[model samples]
Target: MNKKGISMILGIIFTISLAGGVKGIKVKAETNNFTVDLSNQYRNVTHVASGSLYGLSDENKPSDDLLMPTKPNVFTQMAPNGGQLPNGEASPTGDALKVAEKAERSGAKINIRFPDMYKDFPYKWISLDDWNSKIDSIVDSTLASKAANIYAYELWNEPNWTWNAKTSGISFNEVWKKTYDRVKAKDSKTKILGPSISLYDEPWLKNFLTYCKENNCLPDIMCWHELGDAKGVIDVQYIEEHVKDYRNLEKSLGINNRQICIDEYGVTTEEAVPGSMIRYFSEFERAGVESACSAFWFRPGRLSNIITEDGNPNGGWWLYKWYGDMSGKMAMTTPVSQTSLNLDGMASVDSSKKTASVLFGGADGDNNILVKGFNSNKFFNNKVHVKVEEAPWYGVDTKLSQAKEVFEGNFNVVDGKINVPVTGMNKSFGYRMTITNKEGYINRYEAEEAVVNHANKFSNEGASNGQYIGQIDYKDSYVEFNVTAKDAGPYNMKIGYANGNSQVSSQKLYVNGDMQADVNYDSTAGWMSSGKSGTKDVQIKLKKGDNKIRFSNSQNGYAELDYIQLSKVAKTFKVRQEAENALINNATVNLSSYGSNDAFVGMINFGDSYVQYNMNVPEGGKYKLEVGYANGESSASTQNLSINGGENKVITFEKTGGWMASVPNMGYRKILNLSVDLKKGDNTIKFSKGNTGYVEQDYIEVTK
Candidate 1:
C-alpha cells in the first residue's frame, strides 16, 4: 500500500484454517501415485497461494480462488492519529484493527506493519520513547483482539531506498534493531521481518544480513522484492537464479535456512496471459518459497488486479482459482519441455479427489500434455478421464458461472502411458486440465508386447518403464508390434525409444506392410534414461482387426526401441523443433529455458544466415504452423518466415523482455501462429533475418 506498493493480510477466516492453525490438520491418503515422491525430506510449507490484499472492502467478499493467508495493509493512511485511537480500541493503531477484523473473518494470515503516519517515508522520526510507546500500543491492541493470524510484524519497507530512511539521521540497521528489540521485549511470540529491501541487491542484502547477525535480531522470514522486469520481460529464469543466490548468501552468513517471502512481485505483462504468472508459480513451487504478492499500485483498475472494480473475475483471477481449488500434496511430474518456449504450467495430484490437475497455457495452438511415471505396482481402479476448460480474459469479467468444458473424454492407460491432447491453448487464454478416474474406460492391452529381431535381445536393464529391445547396432534391425483394435478409427500411437548417442538416429515405421511414418530418435541422457527420448506421438489408422506395426532402421541401427503404446485417442501428426535434418547457418542452439533439454536456436543477431528444418508432412493441405518463440524487447522484431519455400511472409516477433540484461530477452510465448500449404511428404521451412531485430526460435508444430 505504501510507496513500495506491497501489503500483507492475515485474519480469521470462517472456512479455511489459518496458517498457524493448520499445522494440526491431517492430510488424507492419496489414491494416485505421483512421479515426484514427497514422502520423506520434503515439506509442503511454502504457501504458493499466499498473496496480499488491497483493503478490508476487498476482504469482505474474497474470491474462493485467491489463497492469501497473511496480508498487510498497503497505505499509511490507515495509521492511527496522534499515537492513540478513539477509546477502548487501544492506542496508535487506527483502522488496522478494523482491517484485521475483516481479514480474520475472511480466513487470512495477517502481517501488520508498524504504523508510519509521518509526512514522508517511515512517515516520521521521533524520540526512542515515542517509538517504543507506539509499538507497545499497537501490540497491545492486536493482542487484545486476540488476532492469532498476526504471525509476523514487518518493519519499515524498502529501507534501502534513501527516501524511506530520511528520518532523524538514524541508519536503517539501527532503526530495525531498535524496533525489533522493542517488539520482542513486549511479545517475543510475534516474529519480525524487516529492512524489506526493494530489490535483490547483493551488496544491500549482504549488509542487512550481517547487521541482523551482529545485532542478534534476525527475521523469522526473509523478505525482498522481485519486481525486476523494468525494461524487458520478467525472466523467470533470472528470478530463480537470484533466489538461489540469496540462499547461498544465507548459508555463507552462517544463518539457518529461513523462510522467504517475495512481498512485492510486480506483473509487467498482461496478467490474463497464461505465460504471465504460471512460470512464477512453477519457480516458487520448486524453490519452496513461503509466500508472494503481485504489486498493485492503484486499487480499482490496475492491470495486475485479480479482482476488478465491479467484483468481476479477470482471466488471471481464474488461474488463482484453479490453484486454490487444487487439493492434496504437491505431486511430482516430468518437466514439461514446452515451458522453455513459454508454454507454462504447474501440476498437482489430489489422490483423494482421484484428480491430477494441471494449469497449463501460453501457446497459440493445441499443446500436448503427456502423462508418465506410473508403474505396474501402482494401479488405478478405473479409466483415465481428462477435461480441458478455457479461461479467456477478454470478457470474462464475472466469476465463472461454470467452467465451459471444451473437451472431455475417457481414455485407457496401458503400460503407464497416455497422451492428453490440449486444444484451444493460447497465450491470451488459460486452460485447466483435470485428469481423474472413471468406470468404463477399457484397455485392450494392459501391457503391450512387441517382437524384435532374434539377434537383438530384450533387456530389462536399459528400459525406462519396462522391458525394451537393446543390443541392436546392425543394419536392417527391426522391432514389430502385433496390435488389435476393437474399432476402425484413428488412434494415437506413442513409441518409447532411447538413443544415448550424440547423433540423430532414424527409423521407418511400417504398418501392415506399408510405409507409415519416419521416427526420429534424439539423444537422451543415457540408455537407461528413457525419459530423455520423451514420448513421440504419431497418428495411425487401424482396422477393426489384427494389425502388424514394425519399426526398422534399414540404413543403420539407431536407438533401443522401448515399447509401443496405443490408445483410442484423437490423432495428429506432430513434429518437434529438434527433429532431424536441420540446417543451421547463423543461429546457435542450447537448453536455455524451462523444461527444455533439447537445444533451441537462439541469438539470431545476423541477417544473412538462416536455419532451416526439413519437415515430413503427413497429409498436405492448408495447415496451421505454430512457431514457438520469445522476444522481449520494447519493440517487435521481424523475420523472413517461410514454409515449404512458399511466398515469404513477414513474421512479426513481439517483444518478450526478461529480468536480466545479460540474458536474452526471450520471454516465453508458447506459439506464434502462421498458415502455410504443403505437399504430402517432405517440405522445407526456413527462418532468416528480415531487415530488423533478432528472435529466439523454439520449434514449429504443423496441424490441420
Candidate 2:
C-alpha cells in the first residue's frame, strides 16, 4: 500500500493437463506496459444443471402444481410431460470451455455458469434443514459438470420471495456463510462473492454485511441486486451510491484490492428515457463498480429486457453486446486477467490430499494460463470491455462463443485519482477492473498542497454561496488566489485580511524554493477600502509542479480571501449543471438531504444560460431562477433558493400554481442567460438552500 496504492495483485488460472503454464504477446510500442495475467472468470455463470437446456421429457415431472409457473410459493411444478425442472439426463458439461479458449485467444477471458436458473422454485415456508438440502443439491448438481467455470456459487435466488424465505428460515447471512464455507473447503482457489444487498441503500443491508464480517465471511467480491436503478418508485433510501463511494467503502473496510460488484442490476430500457441504461451503467463503471448484471433475462415474453427477441434495435441482448463487445477486451477483470503469459508446460496439484483445485483460463482444462508483461508495465491506457456469459439464474444471458462486449471504457484521472472500473461489464460475470479515462485528473494532494474550493469563496457547497474570494481579513493585505489555475508560481503579492476592523499583509511567493518578484502591499487606498469600490491586484509566477503562496495573518483573526486572480492563467471553459431539487454530485447524486419543506436546490452557470435547470422560462431573460415549493405569496416562507451578499437581486416567485418559473429578463437567452454580464475577470457563483424534507432534483433544462 505505497503511495501508488497498487498491491497484492494475483491471478486465478486453472492448471490444465500437459501444456499448462502461460502464453504471452506484446504490442511493442507502449511504455506504461501491457500485462495480462489470469484471474477467476466465469466464476459466476459456470454452474450448469443437467438436462434443462434441451427441456425435460415426460418421465421427469414431479407431481405438483405445474399450473403456477411464476408464483413465488409454488415450488413443485408438474411438467407438460410430468417432468421435474431437471428430470432427464446427467452429464459432466459441454464444449463451452472451448469457446472460452477461443475468446481468450482473441484477447478476452471466458467461462459459463450451467444450470442457469437456481432459485426459480417457490417456497413460502420451510425449515433450515430444507434450505441446506436445497443448497446441497445445487452444489452437487453444479459440481457434477466438473467444470471450473461453475467454481463459485450464488446463494438461492432473490430471498425476499416466498420460496427463498420459506426455504432459508434465517437471513441471507446464515445461509450464505454455510454456502461460502462449504465452497471454500471444496476449492480454496475459488473465491466467493456475496450477500448481494438487493440495492445499495437497503434498509436491512447493514445487518447482512455485518453478518458476513462477524462470521469471517468476507467475500472475494460483493454482489447485490438493484431494480429500475433510475425510476425511483423502488423504495431505495440512499439512491445515489456512486462507484467511487462504493469502492472507497471497500477500501475503508481495509480490503486492499478486493472488489465490489452489483450481481444484479437493471436500468429501465424503455425508450421512455434515452441513455437511462447508458448513464446508469456508466456511473458504476466510471465510479469503479466491479461488476453489474442487468435486472434480469426474465422470460422475454414476460418482461422488457430480453436478449433473444426480434425487431428491437437497442434490445436487452443488444445492450449486452454493446456492453460486452469491446475488441479483444470484453473482459475487464483485474490487470492480472490481462497479463498474457507465453509458456508451453504442464503442472498439476492433485486434490487427493483433500486440497483445493482452482481453475482460470485455458481451452479444455488443458491450455496453459497466459500472462503478459512481467516488467513495470500496466497498459492501463487500453480501455477495458467485459463480456459475461449469462446463466439461467434470473434471466441471465449465457453465450460464451458469441459473447457480446459491454462497457468498453477505461480509467482516467479524476481529481487526481486514477479511478478504474471494478464491475458491471457484461452482467453476471467475474468482477472486472479496466482503467478508464473517465476518472479524469486524479488529485492525491496532501493538506498543505491541496484546498478544495467552490467558485464562490468561504461558502459551503450549497445554495447560500458567498462572494468570489471576499477577503475575510481586511487588516493584513496579503491576497491568495483560489487554486483554480494549474501551476501558479512564486511572486511578491498583496493579500487582505482584518485584525479588529482593518488589517492585511503580503508575502513573497515561493513554489518549491526561489522567491517570486515584486512584493507589494499598500495601506492607503487599496488596503483600507477592500471590496468597497474595487480590489487591488497581486501577481506571481509558478513553476510546473506544486507552487505555494503564503499569506500570514499576524493576529490569527478572521481573514477573507476577498479576491485572487492568477497572474498567468489558461482558458478553461466553465459549465455548471444543477437541479431544481437537491442534486449534489453529478455522478453520485442524492435526493434525500432535504426535509419536507426543503425539497429543492439548484446551481447554474450564468454563462451557459441556454442550458436550463430546475425552473424553466417562457422566454429566456436574465431573470433569476429558483427551485422550491411556495404557496400563493410573492415569496413563500420556505424558499428553495437562497442568495448571499444580502440578496443580490429580488427574485419575486409566482407564489402559487404547481412549481412556477420566474423570468427576470424580458427575453429568453438574450438577457436571461446566466452569463448576461460577464465581467472581464473571475466569476464565482455559490449555492445554498435546504428544508425539512429531502430534495429530488431530476434536472433543469435551458434553451435559447
Candidate 3:
C-alpha cells in the first residue's frame, strides 16, 4: 500500500476510536487545523483583559506579582463595607480600592457593584431615600479618592434574581435611573456601567437599554454576566453571538454604540482548566469586547481561579500569563470549528519584538497550526525559531514548576507558511507556540538511544521517538546518555517520564558520576497514555565539553522514561542556603532524617521568631527565591519574607499534605518560588512569623 493509503486507514481507525470515547487513543489526523494570518492584524492584545467578579477578597491576599502577570483589565467587586455572601468571602469595593493602584496601574480598571452595599446576597432593599444616601456616600468616597482607574459604577449586580421591585415599592428601571442620576450628579466624569444582569437575556437587556435611553441615563459601558446555570456548564462559544446581538440591538434602537464588558463570566468547573478558559479568551477577543471578568465561584482572592488557595500559579494562570505576554497586535486566526468546543486558538504578531505567539488547545487529539503570511513581513527571513510548550493541568492544589518545552528548533518557511504539528494533546492542557527571529539551542536525547542497564525499551504512541525505556523498578536499573555541550556552566535538565503510581515517584539523577537532585515525577493516568506523559525540570551543572547524564531508580522507582532534554539555563547564579546555617531566633534546628543536609528549622510559630540568612550574590538584579518548607496543617499556612530589612512580603505556603514524621523521605518537602529584587552585593533575607502559621524550613534556593 502507498503511504497515503496507510495514513488514511490509520486516520479512520483513530476517528472511530474517538467516536467510541476510547481513552488514551492517539490520533494522527490533521483534520483539526487552525490557520493564522500574520499579515492581517486585527486589534491590540487585550484578550487578557478578563478579570473576576469579587476576585480579590483582601488587599494583600494574592500578592501583586501574582495578579500583575495576568494583566487583569477589569475586576468587579462588591460595594464598600459590604461582603455578606452566604457562602464564600467576596472582595468589597473599599478593600478592592486598596489594590486598585497596583491592579489598575497597567491600564486595568475596577467596576463597583453598588447593590452589594446592602449587606445581603439577595440584597434587602431599604427605602428609596436610604438607597440614594448609600449611593451618594459611595460616589462621594470614590470621587474623593481620585482613583483614575475606577472605571465604572455598576448600578446593580445580577438584578434579575437579586432585585425585588414590587417589594421595594419601585420598579427596577426607576431604581436604575435614580441611582444613575444620583451617581452622575456627584461625579459627572466617572463612567457608569449598568443593568448588570445575571446572563445575556435579550428581553431584559432591550427593556433596560430602552428605559435608560429614553430616560437619558444610558450607561457609558454596557455590562452583563455570562455564567453557567445551576449545573455549572457554560458554553463560551456563545460569547460572540451575544456580543453581536447587543451591537444589533444598539443599531435597531438608534442608540449610540457602547463598550461591552462581561463583568462576570465562566463557572466553577471551567475556571482553572486552561483548555476551557482559552475558548472564552478566544471568543471574547474575536468579538471585540472591550473588557470582561471571570466569575468568582470558589475562593475569593484567587484571581477567579488562576491561583491556587496556597498562592501558586495553577495551569490556568500560565495560560493567562501567556496571553498577557502577547504584545503588538493580534492576528487573525481561523479555527477548525468556531461554534463548537473544539480546536481553537489566538495568535499575535509583535513586529517590534520580532516574534509571533499562538496559544491553542481545546480538544484531546492531534492538531496542526498553519502559520501563513510569514513572508509578508520583513522581520522574517527564510527561517525562524519556533518553540512549542504545553502547560499541563496538574490539579488545583498540585504546584507545577513550569511549562514544559515539547518542541524547539528552527523551521524553514515554505512558500509563505509553516505547519506546526501538535500531537497527543490533553483536553485540559493549553499549548503555546512561539516564533522568534533569534536562534536558540535545545538538545533532546531519547531514552531509547541511551545505554540501558536492566531496563527494557517499549513503544509509546505519544513519545517523541515512538519508544521509551521502562521497567526501571530495581535499584540497579538505569539509563545513561552521553551528551555534548558547547559551553555550559549550568543547564536545565527536563526529564520526560510517565509514572502511573498512586503517589509521586522519584529517580536519582547523576551527572558525571556525581549524584544530583532526586527528580520527582507526578502520577499520570496510566502507563503509555497518549496525553498522560509529564516532564520534570531540574537545574544541573554540566562540563563544557562532554557529560554523562544518568537516571536510575533510587529504591524501586516506578516511572518509565521517555526522553531527556538539555537547554541552556537562563539563570546562571543559583545558591542554596540551608536553614540550619541561618541566624535562628526562637527556633530550633533539629536534625532531620530527610531533605538536603539533614537539618531543618522548626518552632516558627512565635510572632518574633525568624531565621535570617546573610549572603552575597554576583551582580544581582532580579532573582527567584525558592523557600523550601513543610506545613502539615489541614489548611494553607503563611510566612513573612523580608529582604534587606525591607517591608515584609507575605508568602503563603501550601499544606504539604504530610509531615516529615508522617511521610518522611522528602515526600512533604515542597518549594515555593518568589521573585525578589536584590542589590549587587550583600543582602539579608529573613523569614518570620507575621500573620503566619507553624512551618518548618528546609532550605532556600536563590537563582537568577
Candidate 4:
C-alpha cells in the first residue's frame, strides 16, 4: 500500500481491541521520587482531623468531613448584650452556649470567643468593674450549660493590633488577668487559649506568655495566623519556614510543650485551590500544628467554598474527600526538591489491606514513584494501577468537565523499592496512586499507536494517556486497529467517542476488508467529560487470529474518537455438514476434498443451477451460518444466497483461480457469513447461481 493507502489502512486497523469487562488491571508505570514506607509510620492520620468552622451554622454547608473541634468564626460575639445568660434573661451569655451546641451537632469541635464588653454593644468603652460583671455573667452561663464539646475559649482576637495597645485606656495584661481570674474561679476545668494574635509576632507572644506565666494563667494552646497579602498569592515555602521558626521560638522560651494551633491559615484571598491547600496540609502535618481552617471569609457559592452554588463538588471538594477517606499512618513523601512543585504529594499505607494511597500534584510528564515496604514477597508481576480523577484547579474552566483518566502498566521492583512509571500527566491534575497486593493486567495498546490517518485540524490533549484521537470527518477518513484475538467467535466492539457539539453523528465500520455496519455517537457533556459521553458497543464476529477493523466517517459526520475496545462474547456451535448431501439441481458432488474431510459440490457451470438444504435446528433462535466456497477463475463471481427462502442477497466471491489451487499457502475456499432466525424444527436455506459466474461450495457451520 502507498503512504495514503497505508495511512487509511492504519486508521482502520486501530479501531479494534479488548477493553471493557476486564478488571483489576494496573496502569502504566511513571517516574517520580514519591515513596512510602509501609512498615515505619509517622503520624496517625485518623487522629489528625483539622479545619476551621466558619459560618457553618446551617445544614447546607459542607462540614462533616473536616476535623472536629472546629473554631466557629462567629459565636456570641455577634449577639447583643452577649444575648441571654443562664441567669434568667438578665444576662446575655446563653446565646454563645447555644451557638456552641449547634457546632457540636454539626460534627465539629465547639469553639467560641468573648465579645468586647464595651465596643461590641453601644460602641463605647466600659470600666474594668463593668467588664468584671460581664465576665462573671459569662462564667455563670458557661458553667450552667455543661456543654462538653467546647474545645477552647479564645482570650481575644488579634490582640497585637485589633486591640489598641496604648489606648482603649486599659492594658491587655489587665484585661487578660481579670477575665482569667474570673473564668478560672468559675470553671478551671475548661481549656483556656490565649492571645489569638493575627500574625506571627514573637515579641508580642513572648511578652504575653511571660506575663501569663508570672500570673500563673498561661494558655493551654498557643495560637497565631498565616495570611496572604492583598494579591491573594500564598507561597507554601514561606508558610513552612515561619512554622519552623515558631517551633524553635517555643523551645527557646521553655514553652515548647504547649500545643500549637495556627488555627487560621490560607494561601489565597477568596479562592482556595486544592493543589496549594494540600501543600499547606502537608506543612501542618510536618510542623505538628493542631487545626487550621482554609480561612474562608464567605460562605458556599463564594470563591473559597469546596461546593458550588449548584451544589456540585467544585475543583477543591475532591481534595477534602480524599483527605477525609484516608486512614492508617502518614508515610514520608519527599519531593525532588522542597521548592519544586513537580513532586508535591502526601502518601499513606494500611498494612492490613496492603494498599497505599498517594494524593499527588504538579505532574506534567513521566515520573518515577519509589515505594518501599510493600507486603508482597516475590515479584507478582502485577502492574502499578493509577486512577486519576481530577477537577480543574478552581479557576480553570476546561477542567470543570474532568473525567477520570486511567493509566496502567507493569513495573519492576527490586529489593523493597517498587518503581512505578506514570506518564501522560497534565499539570495540576489530582492523582491517586494505589499499590495493591492483588494481581493486575497491563493495558494492551495505546490509541495513538493505532491511529492511521487522523485529520490535523483537531487539537490533542492527554494523548500520552491513550485519549488523543479526534477530528473525524468524511467516510474515507478513519482510524484502523490491528487486533489479535486469542479465540474468536462473536465479540462486542466498544468505541469511546465524544460529540460535544450536541449534534448526532456516526462512523462506518469495516472488519477485515468488508464494510460492516455504522456505529452511532451521541453528544457528550463536553470533549473533556468522557464520563458523560460513555461507551458505545456493537456486536461483531471475528475469526481466530489477527483481524483489521476500521472506523470512518465518510458522510461528513462530526465526532471525536478516544479509543476502541473488543471484548469476547459467549457462543455455541454445531457440527459442519457436507455440501454434497444437500438437495441440488445442476450441481454435482465433487469428491475431491477442498481442505476439509467431507466432499464439496462443484461443476455448477450455468446460472440456473441451484443448491438447497433442509436444516434441522436443535433450538429456535438467531444463529450465524458460515458457507465455505472457492472461486478459481481469473475474474470474481457473485452468488445469490437466501435463508428460509427469503429475498436473495448478492454475495461477491473474490478470484481464487481454481478449486484446488493455493496461491502460496492462502486457502481457496472462503467463508460467507450470514445470520438466520430458525424455528426449533426444520428450516430451508438455498444458494443459487447468479449472473457473476460459477464457484464451488464446501461445508457449512452453524453457531449461536
Best by TM-score: 3
Question: How well is each residue in 1-704 modelled by candidate 3, as lDDT tens digits?
Answer: 00011111223221111111111222233336777899888898875555877677666767778877777788877665555562344423335466667566545777877777776667888899888888887887777778878878888888888878788888888988888888887888889897778888888888888898889999999888778643545667777888899999999999988988888787644665777778878888888888888876555677765777678887778988888888899988887785677888889998898999999988876666788888778899777777889887644444556887776755557667776556567666888999987766646677887999998988644554456788888868999998878887777666667776655567788889988756666555456544345555566788888899998997734788877767776656788888887999998886433333445788888978999997677586999988878898887888888999999888889988765433212246677889989998689999998574678888888888
lDDT of 4: 0.56
Error of 4 at 459 (Å): 33
Task: Tell me the tens digit of each residue's lDDT in model 4 across 1-704.
Answer: 00011111111111222232111111222234555555556777742324453434333343443322222222212222353122112333323465555556644454455653343421343566776777677667767788766667666666766665455687888788878877888888877776777667777777887788788888887777766533434455455666677677777777747776665666322234555566666666656666665553333212134554444454555665676656677876766557655566677766656566777665554454556654442323233343334534422111233435354433334455554434444444456666665534433333444656744323223222324466666445777877777676777665655555544456777888778756665444355223222345566777888888877875734666655556566555474565766888888875331223224678777766877877766589998888778888789887787878899888788877556323121235666777778787567777888777777876677776
lDDT (0-100) at residue 648 of candidate 1? 77
Give per-residue CA lDDT, model 2, range 275-394, as digits (tens): 123333333432344444444222211112322122122222333333332222111122121122111111111112211111111111111112222122233223222112211111
Ranking by lDDT: 3, 4, 1, 2
Decide which is better by lDDT, 2 or 4.
Answer: 4
Residue-pair clashes per prediction, in order, are 28, 165, 2, 45
Candidate 4 error regions (>4 Å) = 1-39, 47-49, 59-107, 116-138, 229-233, 300-304, 339-343, 362-368, 375-384, 394-403, 406-412, 420-429, 439-704
lDDT of 2 at 528: 14
| C-alpha lDDT of residue 274 in model 2 | 14
> Once model 4 is optimally superposed onto the true structure by TM-score, how far is the C-alpha of residue 608 displaced, in angstroms?
81
User: Which scores higher on TM-score, 3 or 4?
Assistant: 3
User: Number of the top candidate by lDDT?
Assistant: 3
